[model samples]
Target: MAQIATAAPGWNRFVGVSRPIAAAILGLLALLMAWGATSDVGRDHVRVATSSSPHFDGLVGDHALYARIAQRVAAGESYYTTAAAEHRAGDYPLRPFVAVRLPTLAHIVAALGEKKAQLILLLIGGAAISAWYRRLRTEPDLPRAAAIGALFVAANLTQLAAREWIFIHEVAAGVLIALALALYRPARPWAAMAIVAAAVAIRETVLPVAMLFGLFALIDRDWRAAAGWLAIGLGFAAGLAAHVAALAAVTTPADAASQGWNGQGGWIAYLSFVQASSLLRFFAGWVGALLVPLALLGWAAWRSRLGLAALSIQLGYAMLLMMFARPANFYWAMLVTPTLFIGLVFAPAALAELARSLRGENAPNRATAV
Candidate 1:
């Protein structure tokens, strides 16, 4: 009996030592599942003799356009003139066109080809997971909880959206946005601004998130942070103006309408559609089983002031989408998912408290914690 007890201690030590390895393995498995889903969609695009599926044809088309731009550039055509002229002539939406305008990434894709671009995007997805993990490490109060949070965020349906829609700039933009927000309190304003700029360049919808961050900075009386956010906003506005000017120089007013600028009203309506679609796709299609528990935790987290602010911003963004965009797609709400998941990080603790209360040990204290 003594020998058996001694052996059990060694077994326990092995299990403890292997915990991290197990977690890492699980995390990798989750990522593999996400990658499989993205590859499935990519393969479908190939099967259809297109670069995208029906659900995300916009992204595919954007990639194809980028490829064409790359090809033209490789053939000694001027990028700004040829690509800009083609963009003015095409029916591409403003957001996607702006994303494709990333000169550096565009050149790389042009040099390497679409398959290589897809591989790079996959790496970016992994980088996002690493960023989240880093963010958790910085939060001393949340260190132990960070692993679970990272896993959840990394494997969530939203991350899948990032992978599947690789052609769109939003995936990279979203990661930047999250990293910026995560670093904001660590006196990393410049880093944060860089991310905000990238997100704005990808999609104008990031403006709301920037505004929310600015509001938080203002409330905290952090003038530099507030100023940084203001600069980001101004930069976005300037970019938008430049895009509009370029469009005007190359295309007629009728062409603008065909390109999805049927006045601000139509834009508003389309944004709303995108927001609604995002919610349905998240809840009903991807991550369906985990939604309820996470949502409950998010609600609980909103009791904190910062948490409430985040929730409010998320809701406001959703409303903005409803008001301004038409043909709303689910992925448009991708930015809101991280904030939602951050709030939901408290859910596991809540569950533990509930379990403790049910066992009739320190029930009152545990209930209060919940």
Candidate 2:
């Protein structure tokens, strides 16, 4: 909310806001950024292991870890065996399968090979961005700034996917979420549900998002959408239950490792970047920490109908982080912030529209605004 401008058409064409309100949100964002940069809620993690558990080996840069898992799976070892050993080596929790990663990425990469698997994922990401662009074009008008922002978002996504974010499944989840948003038409309920199911498989954390989406659709009285998503949610919940039950059955009491934390730190633990063993990773963590408030603001000001689902997922994940944050958990922000960047860069205009409504100005009416 730095300034008022909406230069796009269709979904985001109404971003103009008053300068004073824009300034206020920006000021708040800046203060939060400053607080994050200065605070050290878990600085002790920089000097020593913050976990109280004797077995906690600290965070493994999961890129290499995942690659190793794929290699092991390719070598014909059972996933549970390889995963258990890896977790034991890293001192990650095993009881109730807290640290065991979902098998989607590993299984896919093992069967398809790294290059080919990533290529398919990249294609899916591109398709999702293209779908959003097409939806924007059908709006009958386009703002220059909004158009530019759209292009910027797409380009940033491409660059991010080609880099570290692509190594993670959540990157695909972001793009799939975008695709789900683009395809959420009354006539295309099945298509949207399919995309969401794929996304949840890629990253199970998105299960809550699917549930919230159905809840929103129900509120809208869109029976088809609500029913379709509800069907997918039930299916996903059942699959997750089966998977967890299988893991639990396999693990004995000895495999149940203690999950520990730095009792001293609360949510502010995100600032203690230096605690991370890798200099580059810690730097990325700091940047992600700083972006959190701005992302929250942008998510708040977003005006798309799909913004309801996006915000629900974004806020839900943020609350989960707030409730569970530790020194290592600071990096989780980075995992979730890529798609959130789409909202952050084009936020000013949406803030303006929201402000206008508050001030009894000519606020945007969805049917005629674009």
Candidate 3:
């Protein structure tokens, strides 16, 4: 009997029960919080924003690479030629549908020119932030927690604009994701659906978030919403499949570098980003640190369905980063930074609530007078 009493709590479970599940969630959350704090997001933000004329003239690293890519498109070059030039030093392929990226931003930049495109994106981002902010005046029953999400997203984007991380599709996707969540309502489901679908086009990483919305809708027994999201996911998947087929049809150049471009890396590459000299400076982005907590905290916050979806996107990206997110590929995370910081902004409250629930589940309760 004493041994039984001494046995760990929750050890008597038979089916549909396990202590490891809770432990895993807690562990991941802790790691994310710790890393997000120490990864120097603030430092990186300052550095990027303070860089001299080199950055202004588009003579830096990936910023320059992307700028040059846009210039080539503006000059009427094909995707292959533009991407090929920067990647010649690396083994990256010059294929049409290279996982390196999609052509959404390039197309926009080509049409508008980089400076003009920058101004346009800044305006659109401002409008999105304003739209969500205006909801505070209108949404009466809305909880303060919801407003946290709105402010978080708006602030992150504003920082991006201030720092000139303009027009990256991921930033656009993040804006759309926030807008979708803020405006997601039973009265006007179509608007939310359209925004989320547009995010899928901007960055496929957002597709799972769309699917998670479907799952949440199913749980809420909103079959129409579930069906709409399911259809969106299907269409997004079909588009990706077509892109892959096109990539296969256009063979990589014989002279193209091929060091580790095709989905390569493991624990070594994952941990390498932590080293001072590591080429893949994850914190180079203004909000890289926030990605960790945003993913973890949002996942644990049961009250926020979109938070959970943001967590899913973060986890998916984490796995991809572990495998394929090399130093050169850090730009991948750029697409998701908006959502990451937004999630990070609301993490403290979500974490406190999560802590209370976990303590309630684990602590031995006594019948004390309340």
Candidate 4:
């Protein structure tokens, strides 16, 4: 019996370890299936349409700009000169111009075709998901329950959809921005700043993210880290200013009409209709369906003093986006999506704790079970 008991404990420990590993692997498989299904759908739709139509083209203007930049790099042209000339000529859209100058990611996408670029993005998405899972595993309040939240965020439908469509700045930005917030707890402030910088450069609509990072530093009373974030913001502003100046100098006022600029309000209206058309189309629907339970887990974590500040920062940024910006698409809010998912992860754990407390008060004589 003694030998059997000892072996049983060892067996239990092995099972405990294996279970989480199995869960993680399963979660990853789910993510891959979701991604593959969406990608196939997108390919089918594209195949049916005329390739010459701009709408059917996988990577349009900015994508073409990145390709040209890569071709120039392959031919031994400096990145700055190539980027500057493109800016002056108004050869690419504003968002792509900013993204292409960022060297690391731009070069990678430029070196590879659009399909390969998407695979790279999927890898990054996987990394972000894995990071969240790691963080959840260590959480004291709801270590086991947190996995549910991690899975929800990791295999989010919108993320899967974005992955299939190449050249999505918001999708990439979401992962990087989440990574930065996740890093802040480890005291790796410089690394966090770099991630935030990359996110802002991808999509200026999420500039609020840089400010939120600064706020996190201040709230933690880390002045040096706060200053680092400020420096990144200043650098971004300077580059943007220079680009704007060049654009202004080269283009006649009337040419702005030919630049294919659509008003943001119209885009927002279109996005809203898209959201109404399908349950899956609404970004929030994914949150409600898959992420709400995880958010409850996050709420539990917040009560336990694990991720409160990050939660606050994310919520504040979301409110700011809703009020101030007419988002070009539902994905513009991607920067906060991970944080929101984190919140979802904690929500259920928090509710469970609450239920236990209420039961304890209401039925003091009854045995309480976890």
Consecutive 10-residue window with the lowest summed lDDT within model 3: 8-17
Report each candidate's C-alpha RMSD, comma-separated, in the order given.
11.9, 6.0, 9.1, 11.2
Ranked by lDDT, top first: 2, 3, 4, 1
* Tens digits of per-residue lDDT for model 1, 337-358: 5445654555444433334434
Residue 4 in candidate 4, Cα distance off native in Å:
32
Clash count of each predicted structure: 19, 11, 4, 19
Q: What lDDT score belongs to each candidate, Candidate 1 first?
A: 0.49, 0.59, 0.54, 0.50
Best by TM-score: 2
Which sequence of candidate numbers ranks them by TM-score, best first? 2, 3, 4, 1
lDDT of 2 at 188: 55
Best by lDDT: 2
lDDT of 1 at 29: 36
Model 3 lDDT per residue over 42-115, tens place: 33222221212244264565455566677778899875456655555433445445444666667777888767
Residue 29, candidate 4: how far off, in angstroms?
A: 33
RMSD, candidate 2, Å:
6.0
The sequence of per-residue lDDT tens digits that candidate 4 reaches over residues 1-370 is: 1221122111111122233443553354345334433332211111111112242234444444445555576567765666655544543333433333454445555568657777766776676677777776655433344555566556452453443334446567777776766565636678767877887776665577677667778887888988887888898788677766654454444332322323233322322322322233445433243333334334423532236556565555445543443323344455556556556544433333334443343212222111
3 against 4, candidate with superior TM-score: 3
Per-residue lDDT of 36-111 in model 2, one digit per residue for the tens?
A: 6666534553333232223212223555455666778978887777777666665557776546667776788788
User: Which of the predicted structures, 1 or 4, would earn the higher lDDT when compared with the native?
Assistant: 4
Off by over 4 Å in 1: 1-63, 70-124, 137-143, 157-164, 186-188, 256-293, 296-310, 323-325, 348-370
N/CA/C clash count, model 3:
4
